[model samples]
Target: MNEHQRRLLTAAGLTELRFDAPMSECCTLRAGGTAAALIDVQSIEELRRLLALLTDEEIKFLVIGRGSNLLVTDSGYSGAIIRLKGECNALAVQERGPDFALVKAGAGCALGKLVSWCGGQGLAGLEFLAGIPGSVGGAVRMNAGAWGQETGALLFAIELVDKDGRIRQISVDALRLSYRNLALADGELGSSILTAAWFRLTADEPEQIRSRCAAYLERRKGKQPAGAASAGSFFKNPPGDFAGRLIEAAGLKGASCGAAMISPVHGNFLVNTGDATAADILALAEQVQAEVFARFGIRLEPEVKIIRDESCQ
Candidate 1:
């Protein structure tokens, strides 16, 4: 962002800003170049103000959750990065009926935190998110799921700000989700920011909810690699077929390029052994896709969001 724009942001009550923020620090992949600016957005009001400013000035910006599913390239991002904070991270019961409760969760709330909160409140249906590592907003935007439960399926409504800085609370009918993809029916995925989500979860015994959550976490841990730097899964599962199965069947279970490797424990996971650059991971993923396609005549699509250098893109 330019100096005058920075001054405008400050005057707009959105002051936590850093110029040339390193994306490596922002992403879970632990490797990236830099963002032109990084702003810690503190509230819904602050978010609206910033969005208005960016829209008016024609500045590009991206609202990031926990950055778990993101892979930013070494050449860097050309826009500013906005991280939600304050009211954007709050969670509460919006309404309660006899059989179900509507829960409001800020987009910035950690998925794990929401899961734990659900378990504590005896809310059923979100146990599948036990081990997911992104923010609620990210999860909803990406349609994150496990064990046949997708986040989009449970959400009744979503709050977001459009590209023009208009805040909206759209119905789930406006959300189009399939496999691991989520897009608003309005087609605002590129510029709109998901601010919060409301989920309709049925009531259950707290102990039961917790038990189910634990089981899901256990299954995830037993199957996926633990304590290694990696996105949860690399490829989307094809119809009636698992990506991990194809990857392993193609003999890429323990493949490596530089520090990046397809996990031996789970063929779907691409890991950074220590110093894997973003390019290393992308190259490795591409190799997986090519080999799998060559062997099975099926091309694998990445579930991880690869952030390319805008210059090259």
Candidate 2:
């Protein structure tokens, strides 16, 4: 099935397909095994065609962007990995007024780059996402937030492809966006592939917007570990209490399992100390969950998407 899909994709004009592609190069964690195949898609037409081929051949696939929040297992993925490239990296202002503007961005645009673009253009409201990692698609799907503002608050609409290959323009309300999650009309989590998104932002002085971005970046620098391999915060804050505070309160800061450790700089962060394996990280996370649950009665939920399956090996 996978071979048939690959041949079809190649015949359809994709030449950047790789077999046993290194996952470490793709994810932020910097530690993961190879995948079965990785396909670099250049345009929407190519994606549509490739997805059709995969669907017809019954080959399992996952779409990825920047791979910031992904944690791949050491055993590797046994399915196709589709990555957006080229034309999907666009960011442009669709409509502009004295006090507001509608910025339309491609799904593969880096969240940080989008924020920076807005700052440079004197657009405000996305300053909170200044240093946040991942692409616009991933941000929208996860409702990625920082400070007090979330991605959903600024999202006006999204163009996404449904399971049946139907392209739909959905309003923010239709997505039912919530804290770190998006839901469908059926009350289930959404799995649509986002192609682009429109965000509403207020017009501000570029200097003012840059100042706010600087402040946010500085705050992140002070609180989060820099120059290390990590998937941002390991766990989401549970309700009113922060996961960092809980893990710190449980005395797990700087705790280690092999080379993976709870960062001393931030208890909510799990860092890969050069040689940490996915298993090591998972073990440390489990230990942190157990200790925090026992002490504070709050079971920490991982924010990082741990990609693993029976076929990982």
Candidate 3:
């Protein structure tokens, strides 16, 4: 590590930080190389302090949640990796009115667990998020949605730490959420961190809510490939058309590029059948996009975020 990074690490009281931490162990895809350094921040205060130190040193860092929608390169990241898995998992029903309640969840709270909690409490709006595997912060950033409902729909407001380490509140409208995208600007990219989100949900019959959530979970089980290493749907559905349908039509199902294969069960999903590398996944994805474009004249865009080393061509 550089002198500046070494000094900053010592100053933050995190001298025991992991060097070359395995990226595969932290990600859902179970692939990729290691981070140059992995610092686990377990509290808001620690996170704030760490960010301050990193910013002062001008270190490039990334805030990772559950690592569900990520693809790190085989060569690994050269900068520090900040993770908030255990620390930012607080979730609670903060307030309740006559007909609705305000539920507050930390950014790192599991999206599925939050939905399950809401469903158990007879909350109606979060049933659609029951099976989506991601952290609440990542969900909000991705505007994650399934079965026609999105995270932004229930988000009343979000608490974030700005670049200057100042805590700020941004409302749902300010997010400018679209399909699989949020309003995280370039300046606020890694500098700002999502802390918590307030969700507004209506009171409903518990049995009905449970039934709906169960149905959603069942549907997800039927559609998505389970018990496999994957990053969920690889491509966002093209406007007025489905990416899976296009890929399937192009005869890309079960197509393999090294260890990565377009899932035979779901065309939009690329699964690592053990021993897949980031390069393999990228090649498979590119081939799918190319074949789909050649067949239907529609270009498929990746929903998964690819983080590669600068040295990677």
Candidate 4:
């Protein structure tokens, strides 16, 4: 962002603006350089205003949620980074029927918190996502899922603002949500910022919902590395096959490059053993992919979002 844009944002209720914000603090991978600017919009109005200003100025910007599935490179992004706050983090029950309830959640609300809230309200259908991390907007955008329950299954509608600063509401059917994917009518991803999501969840006993969520959490704890600096699973499961199985079968378990290592417990997880760089992790992931392809004749596709500077080598 330039000096004029910075002044304009400051005058337009954007109080929090940092120059060259640390990208490592924004993601689970904990490896990144810096961004040109990081601006936190505390309300929908603020977000819209900022989006308009950025669009009018033709300044490139990216909206980020909890940053759970992101992997920023050692050489960070040069454009502005936009994050939501305030009303964007709110969650509440909009309507309640005899058998189901309509729950509205802000895009910036943490996915885990929303799940816990739903469990407390005896809402079913989101228990499968008990252990996943990220924000509601991010989850809906990616159609994130676990244990066969995807985000789109419960979604009823979404309010979003497109890249051109136009706000609109779209039904769940309009999202075209598939396995780990959500696309606009134009098939373009990240061209819109989801402001809120509405979900229809069946009313159940709180204990039952909690129990189901606990079981899902237990399963994740048993298979994935706990308290490790990593971006969850590295690769999406291929058709009729699991990426972790292929990685493990290819002898990539416990593999390391610098301080980045494919978790011994789960071959698909790439963990940072302190001082791990993005380059190191990428190198290890590429090596594992090559080995798996050579051994199983299947190429692995990464699920983690990798961010890199265009000028970086």
Clashes of each: 0, 0, 0, 0
Q: Cα lDDT of model 4 overall?
A: 0.86
Q: Model 3, 1-313: lDDT tens per residue?
A: 5766866686678523787898998788888988878887777787888778777877778777788899998989877887775557888888998889999898988887888788788877988888777899889888899988888888899999865678888877666778997774333344578888999999999899889988988998858888889989999999998999898889989999888999999999999999999889999999998888888899899999899768433
- The candidate that achieves the highest lDDT relative to the unseen native structure: 1
Candidate with the larger TM-score of 2 and 3? 2
TM-score of 3: 0.94
List lDDT for all candidates, in order. 0.87, 0.85, 0.84, 0.86
lDDT of 1: 0.87
Cα displacement (angstroms), candidate 3, residue 275, comes to 0.6
TM-score for each of the candidates: 0.95, 0.95, 0.94, 0.95
- What value of lDDT does candidate 2 attain over all alpha carbons? 0.85
Looking at model 1, report the run of 10 residues with the lowest lDDT sum.
Answer: 6-15
Runs in model 3 with CA error above 4 Å? Answer: 1-4, 184-190, 311-313
Candidate 1 clashes between residue pairs 3 or more apart in a chain or in different chains: none
Q: After superposition, how far is residue 185 of candidate 1 from its true place, in Å?
A: 2.5
Cα displacement (angstroms), candidate 3, residue 117, comes to 1.7
Give the TM-score comparing model 1 with the true structure, all chains together: 0.95
TM-score of 2: 0.95
C-alpha RMSD for every candidate = 1.7, 1.6, 2.1, 1.5
